[model samples]
Target: MKGRSVILGQINGLEAAALMVDGQLEDLLIDSSGFAPLPPGAICRAKLGRQMKGQGGVFVDLPEGQTGFLREGKGLRPGDTVICQVAGGAEPGKALPVSLRVLFKSRYAIVTPGAPGLNISRRIRDEETRDGLQALADMVMEGSDMGLILRSACEGTEDGEIVEDIAAMRDLAEAVMADLDGAPELLVDAPTPHEEAWREWAEPAPDEVIEGDFATHGVLDAIEALASPRVDLPGSGYMMIEPTRALVAVDVNTGNDTSPAAALKANIIAARELPRQLRLRGLGGQITIDFAPMPKRDRQALEQQLRAAIKGETETSLAGWTPLGNFEMQRKRDRVARAMLIGGTE
Candidate 1:
């Protein structure tokens, strides 16, 4: 309850994994209950469809009459079959976003077909470790045409484990790339929430790993708090995260604070907390934040705070302040919403 804990459980028959740090929910991943036409990270073979003309993308013919939209459609024509990976989660009744640049990713390595290179993650600054990893990559990828990227997780990992991980992924990529006879078929399925938690959250091992039910670890309560409209911030402040049809609107407020700097304090707190809030809630796309009333001079400082908070979030992009004095951002949809994951639908 007071340290980093990884809780795995089931919600409405779907799988879920939650990460709690110092009793606060840091991250959450809930299974999509197979509702997603193409879950994130899914690789498939699809028949290319004609361009939409106005959308700057073409439709892909997925299995079971499902269609995916690929934004990069250069040199592709109707009836041509190409391999693609699910770019992100799909919107309700919309085409699943797919990318022509397929990548095979794992905890320790990423195998990129059609690309050729061997590199190490920049996070691992130890030159000795990088050289050893590069040697291992060369050994395993000697004859391979695809690119091999050793992830940062390889920093302290054992050589045997890293070798095996790279080999397995290399084999998978080779096998999948050769499967050209399929008719709009799924080649690889996405990892389950619990499995992905293990794959991604192993860098800084959690203090505890609770497997089984959620009630024992108070995960249910944390999830319930996320389902609420208001998130209590520091200094008795709070913010309401409301997802409307067009965009997610967050309204911050300073509660019962008459101090002169109350607005700036609350606004800074909101900037620091909004990333995790939006991430855990699985809210994406357009986001508009109306912070507590503060001086225009403080906006730059608050934006700096917000940028620092979301710098590591690859799917989030800070769009800067709008003319209406609201901060706007664009986040790529990477997972199904909490509503759909917990309740199957809104």
Candidate 2:
């Protein structure tokens, strides 16, 4: 997936859940497990784990089992669960850390490293600019217990947008601070939904497109307009793509073929369809494609043809078939393959 998708819930406070495209839950960096209460600024050792439904790693008091989550994109190992002490408590469930003495311990600072063309520090200063920057710093330094990175929105952003974000953070901070003693001790800021972000950032402009029977017409029309001059596959042959933490598999079948050379023809046709399928489905990362088998000679020719077909595509690497007759390939994980396959509808 290109970005994070959020799930909303309430447990004393608002909680946002984020999952990968294939549904592997990420870590949410706030403490949720009830345990010994640590006052704000009290240093205490804790343990942390990456939750499957949020965007960051969660922290917990090691021996107590009370959990806390860290920010997304923080490199966390599945096995390197750590021991951390609370440096301070902010917004109830949120805590700050003092030292990195524990394994897999993430820092409590939010820093957005800048890129060559994307300068994050560059901003438009105005009356609201000063107030917004100060408010953002205050929220990061006080409200959230973990580090915060100013999103790309900070790049080339106007004072008004900055002020708006600052205002949102301020409101969230106020709510969190106010509910520290109430039934909602932990307050969660609503997470921005993926669909809204995708609509704003990655909506494509295509010339012509095709939609499957399962797809909505409005979505299909939008995709068709973006992928103009494209054609859809005919007949009953279908492909199923499944992505897992281990690997991605693409299965191609000859749904309605009735020819004597059905196997060979299906293999060839599937091979021909492979390139388009990969592109249309946005299949990436480590990929394995299995097609109905053909004769040895035809298999060799088909492999060569398929390889040639996808030679110029970006960020795609292909390898010849193995003795077991499956094609092995690699694609960079960036976009959602499922969305592409469904023509960006689902």
Candidate 3:
């Protein structure tokens, strides 16, 4: 109960994975069926479709009459075949988001086919360690044309595993790249929930791993709670998260607290916990936060806390305070909304 644990289990008949740290649910990933035909990270051989006028983008043919939108179509004409990776799920009836850049990502290494270079994560800054990793990369990637990047998770991973990971990804990349004449089909299927957990949660390795029986560990109940919008905060504060057609709205409130610093305290709590809430719920897009009434001078403090909260996030951008005293930010659509998992929303 005091260390990190990964639960690969089924919740309400759906495959799900949860990362629990110190008995608290830190992260969750669920394989949502009907989210899309090709889930994120799926690779396919697709033929370019008609281009969107004034949009600077084109659609690609997917299996079963499905199509994907690719934003980087310059110099490429319709009917041209190109290998693409599924970027993320589409919004309802829209085309699936896709990208021309394909990457074979594992826990230790990410094999890059387009970019050619051997790079180490900046987190590994020690000169001696960096030198050792460089040598390792050179040895493992001998005669390889594709690029290789050692992830931060590689810092404490075993050398043999690191080597195997790099080699495996490189081999997979080679195989994927070699097939060029196939009909539009899936080359690589998206990773499963448990597989994704292993690939992502390998570093800082969990203290324990539990397989199945998610209900035994309260994961099922947690999922139901996550589907709700009212998240209770410290000092009797709470925030309601609602997703709409255009954006996510966060409204903070200090519940029955008479303290003079109630407004600021509620806002501070909201700022710190917002990212975690969004992450567990898989809610992303344009987000606007309406903090409880506070002084204009408090904006700087709230912004500071918010920036610190998102420092570790890669796909979110802090767009700063709005003219109407609201705060806004943008995030990538990485996964299906948690509410959809429980059939709370369409």
TM-score of each: 0.94, 0.35, 0.93
Ranking by TM-score: 1, 3, 2
Error of 3 at 278 (Å): 1.1
Over 4 Å off, model 2: 1-218, 221-233, 336-346
Q: Is candidate 2 or candidate 3 better by TM-score?
A: 3
Clashing pairs in 3: none
Over the stretch 1-346, how does candidate 1's per-residue lDDT look in tens digits?
8988999988778888999899888899888747885688888989999899989999999875789999898888888888888877766788888887788888899999988999998989998998999999999999999999998889889999999999999999999988878699989988889989988887677888999888777777878777787999977899999998788999999999979999999989888898898888888889999988888999999999998999878478889988889999998877777866765321
Number of the predicted model whose lDDT against the real structure is largest: 1
The C-alpha stretches of model 3 lying farther than 4 A from their native spots are: 344-346
Superposed model 1: Cα runs more than 4 Å off: 344-346
Candidate 2 total steric clashes: 33
TM-score winner between candidates 1 and 3: 1
Please give the distance, in angstroms, between residue 120's alpha carbon in candidate 1 and its true position after superposition.
Answer: 1.7
> What is the per-residue lDDT of model 2 for residues 241-325, given as tens digits with 9 covering 90 to 100?
6655557677777667766676666666666666655554444667887876666777677777777766756456777677888
lDDT of each: 0.86, 0.41, 0.86
Q: What ranking of all candidate models by lDDT puts the best one first?
A: 1, 3, 2
Please state the error at residue 136 of candidate 2 in Å. 42
